[model samples]
Target: MGTVRDILQTKGHAVYSIHPDITVFEALRVLVDKNVGALIVLDNEKVCGIFSERDYARRVIVKGRASKETLIREIMTENPISVTENDSIEDCMVKMTEKHIRHLPVMDHQDRLVGMISIGDVVKYIINEQKYIINNLEGYIKGTR
Candidate 1:
């Protein structure tokens, strides 16, 4: 019965991002330092795209481009799919499955970014919910609420 907001509360909603103009080198540093898989690429405080490790491997490493000279925007996934906070974890699971993305940025009803959720978050919540249900069932069998 927990919500995405609940999971975020335990994990923290801090998202690491960078400007589109930043060098891949700088972006890589931030990614490594933050220990995150992706970043919300910002332009004037608005999201333009997302940069992930896959993007670097595909666009820069495979293409033989120097990370130090390449811009993050060039390799980021443009116009990436997004989700809102009101959306159910089920809804997010469906979207992520269809799109094959691991991270989803949660927005408010007004479309302002609020938090981000990863596939791991969804799995954790689902697992926790199952455990809670099983415990409740055991308690019920024992004539407890």
Candidate 2:
């Protein structure tokens, strides 16, 4: 039953972003440097969209567009779906599954970008939560709780 807040607190709310006007080559370099698959497309400190490797494969490569010549905005997913820090992990999973998305940008109550979470983060958190629950149950059964 952990919330997105718990995950953010554990993982730290650091977001990597790129400008929509940047070339896809530049964005891809940032992605490699950051070791991440997605980057938030920020304009004036606001979430505008998201750019991912999938964007390159689907929008650029498949379409025979040059990465150096193509702007990230041309390939980025515009107005990507986002979640708040208070949103439940279950809610994020449902949205991601339904939308066929891998990453979700997290916002605060003030509508400010806080962090981003991948489906991997959610699954890892859930696995850890289940492990904790199982350990507690075992402790109880062993009269150790």
Candidate 3:
């Protein structure tokens, strides 16, 4: 019954993003500073796409594209799959698996970008839910609940 809100509440929904027109080098600096694998490519504060360190390696460095010369939009994944805050962790997992992605941005009912979630976050929430269920069952068995 747990949702992304639970994970966000614990892990925080604050996101680090970059503008689409910024050079790949600038985006790289933000990624390194945040120690995150990806950055939300924004256009006027709206989620435009997503760029990851992987994209830079595959599209820029390996392909002879200069990081300082290339733009994030040139390499970013456009219109990334997004979810709502009310969505269950299970729903998020299915979407990521079908899409073969590791990250998903969460939004509100009005489609306002809220936070980002990773596969690791989904796994952690599931583990915590299982533990809670087990603990409650044990307590009930011991007549303590």
lDDT (CA) per prediction? 0.86, 0.94, 0.91
Which digits, one per residue and each the tens of the lDDT, describe model 2 over residues 46-119? 88999998898999999999999999988899999999988999999999999999999998888789999999
**Tens digit of lDDT per residue, candidate 3, span 121-143?**
89988998999999999999999
Task: Sort by lDDT, best first.
Answer: 2, 3, 1
Which candidate number has the best lDDT?
2
Once superposed on the true structure, which residue ranges of model 3 sit more than 4 Å away at CA?
A: none
Candidate 1: TM-score?
0.91
Comparing 2 and 3 on TM-score, the stronger one: 2
Better of 1 and 2 by TM-score: 2
Worst 10 residues of 1 by lDDT: 1-10
Ranking 1 against 3 by lDDT, winner: 3
TM-score of each candidate?
0.91, 0.97, 0.91
Q: 16-48 in candidate 1: lDDT tens per residue?
A: 889999999999999899889899998887788
